[model samples]
Target: MTSTHKNGLSPASVETIAGLSAGLISTIIVHPLDIIKTRLQVDTSSHPLLNSSRAVLRDILRNEGPTRFAALYRGLTPNLLGNSAGWALYFLWYREAQDVIRNLRGYNLGTQLTSVDYLAASSASGILSAVLTNPIWVVKTRMLSTSATQTGAYPGMIFGLRAIYKTEGIRGFFHGLTPTLFGVSHGALYFVAYERLKEWRKVSKKDQTLTNLDTIVASSLSKTFAGTLTYPHQLVRARLQTYDPGATKRVKGPGLVPLIQQIWRNEGVIGFYKGLFPNLLRVVPSTCVTFLVYENTRWALPRMFGNADDDPSNRTTVARKGERAL
Candidate 1:
């Protein structure tokens, strides 16, 4: 669609489309790390051997043989569906929330939205995305841990959900709701840092927009900081998502602290961050790609399609009130 609704595309739809494209591309390129990150977090192997991205890569090469590379993408279908929907909904909610907040406060594109604004918007977006996509992720996690020889795990999204429904009932899809809800704090921290970094760059450069490299640095740093702080919750979430037959017998309460305590007692404190390295490896680059693609698409689409929004001098006419410029 060209600018100004000429080709019938709304700004919200454009943002969604851009997010879908970016998420798919990033997932395709970096998913092996994602797989490794999940496996490491969920793996009960002694001492967490799959610590490094290289180690995971080495394992795939050593153990999988000819299908080694393909093996790395074992859960690509669930991943693509889950991630695509998450990004699309994230941007949708994020943009709408920013618009509402901007209207309430008279925030201007003439000046930037504050980091607080970003954090609030991102927190809402993260929760919405997580709730809607949790089932897909439960299936995805099972797929990731599924062995090539194991016929127990379902083959696709529909089958996986059906199996979970049959075996664990309606509550099965929300296996990790507690830790996942806790993980929304990660988004709050991430967007605050990222938005502030962008603001600082613009002020330092004496410019209205950031260069691509500046965007990358901000996105990477923000991801690393938030990812590291919240990684333990992620480990908890991954473990929670899987079916634990012993959980009912062993764990005392059906609450967050008990889960943490269970993990602590059995696997120790290190269990909560088993895959931090590989997760960081995936987080930094993938986050950079997401913002890079988003920023560029938001800027390029308008200019290419002649939407006055991207005209360097005209901030007011941008499709979304607080849409990132350049």
Candidate 2:
């Protein structure tokens, strides 16, 4: 794909658009598994994590059939809205940061930025987006859990927001801030490794077809590595956001450390990795679809939407094939 977007639209801006498109597409595709993963993760039943997912799924499918199956998409609207906006902002900031790095290093427009550049950009954007969208996630988790367990029914995103705000106040939306900050590393590691691997493939003259198996493998493996490394934080975050009526009686006062200790003391080290199997089953393909879509969209959008060549600045600011312009 050409870097014409980088030339006129600002690479990061176009990147944001691509990220939004990709996020919506992937969320729609994998949300069922996401809801299933959450149910399995937050489950306190004695059944093993993997088995609990199976049992829950089997019970739901057998008893409720079409009704429960329909309920599986409980929080999908907020999930899609949150994810699309979050990803778009993530890519926008990251690519804009990349542009800044290129300027600092005296690199031109189309230059292949280093992994370190990607790391910085991805980490900053990931954390910022996570913090801003944490409320949506909180609402999403609650809605999904409620619908899955047939507990409370949230009329809509607005109703869910009002309920949480009324019950928990502003702080309610930030239920998992600490663990989310930690999960920033997941985005950092994944983007760095993924971009580096792509660079490696290109350097080795292996930019095969657009949606090759290698691209999928690279995206999936990078996500898996990051997810494994940061899996504990995810568990804690889920548990933190998940409200149980009796939680106050079980754990110490409100804090991440207390929650961490509670899990460790109760479930031991294994507590931190609940639902890894099901999560991976969803995540690997979810990431693969996201990256694949992002790449394709970024590649296609320049041709589809831009008229940079007709712009006076673009005509005057020509640079080499792999070099960028100011």
Candidate 3:
């Protein structure tokens, strides 16, 4: 029998809900950091000090006038939509893929999955979610990279999409897709570190499941590790997706290889990590909130809605075991 939450939702549905909720809440809390990160990534100023998070944030607030505070959340609508949908799809696909692999392997209930399983499942899920949601990301990058004072700045997500469609056609929405796909390694690394960290904590503490604090710490560390190593791809992707408000033709930018070469030639290796500081600041807490909310929501939903006994962790043998399956 297919296991369902007490609320009559499948486990996958519950996970999707959790992911959506997590992304929505976390994005709202940390959007200002996102704006800073995006601006820093696209900034090509020769002076390193000019590109610092503090400088960028101060510039926005001091110069943007009435829109200063609001500017911190410039692309909020698309960002919210993209993150909520992306995380939802990622968790759903990841959990389903893990189940498929487990069933194929004939693993018994509550069997611990290997790191290889996590890599495969996370990679597949990341690629699928990244592909499906690239358009929203393109729109978000446009809104964030464009100053509020810019002539062709989009007023909202709908307007942004319509503008891109009219001006750049459907192809505009998939900008930077190549680097985005390559960035899947980031997610794979994150999940592997996350699961392994939880396992290590459980072993050290002699506990079967981790506390909420443990989950937060694990996610923060995992995000740091994955984000630091794979951050260059994000910089490249952001640059490729940057909007040119003055352009009438297709959004023109260097291809993946040439762009990387350009950054290398002009800015050196540090250019690829332009926003690492603010990104880590944003992503670490954002990841903590996401995993914490996801795990807690999954735990609470069934009990709050109907069945108090539907433990999400034990749903399948290959279900994430330690750290409350966050």
lDDT of each: 0.74, 0.73, 0.84
lDDT of 2: 0.73
Error of 2 at 172 (Å): 0.7
Point out where model 1 deviates above 4 Å. Answer: 1-4, 45-59, 62-66, 244-255, 310-326
How far is 142's C-alpha from truth in model 2 (Å)? 0.7
Better of 1 and 3 by lDDT: 3
lDDT of 1 by residue, 98-185 (tens): 7778888986655567778888888899998999999999999877766444546556778878878877778888878778888999
lDDT of 3 by residue, 1-326 (tens): 34875446667777899899999999999999998889889988644733488888888888763676687878899999999999999998998888888998899987878999999999999999999999999999989887777777787899988888888888888999999999999999999998888888877774355788878888999999999999999999999999778666664678889999999999998888898888998999999888888878877766566765654655421223354544
Best by lDDT: 3
TM for candidate 2 is 0.84
TM-score of each candidate structure, all chains considered together: 0.86, 0.84, 0.93
- Clashing residue pairs in candidate 3 are 110-317
How well is each residue in 31-134 modelled by candidate 2, as lDDT tens digits? 87787777766765445777777876776566542486476677898899988998898977776676678788998766777778888888888988999999
Off by over 4 Å in 2: 1-13, 63-66, 108-111, 148-151, 206-211, 245-253, 308-326
Ranking by TM-score: 3, 1, 2
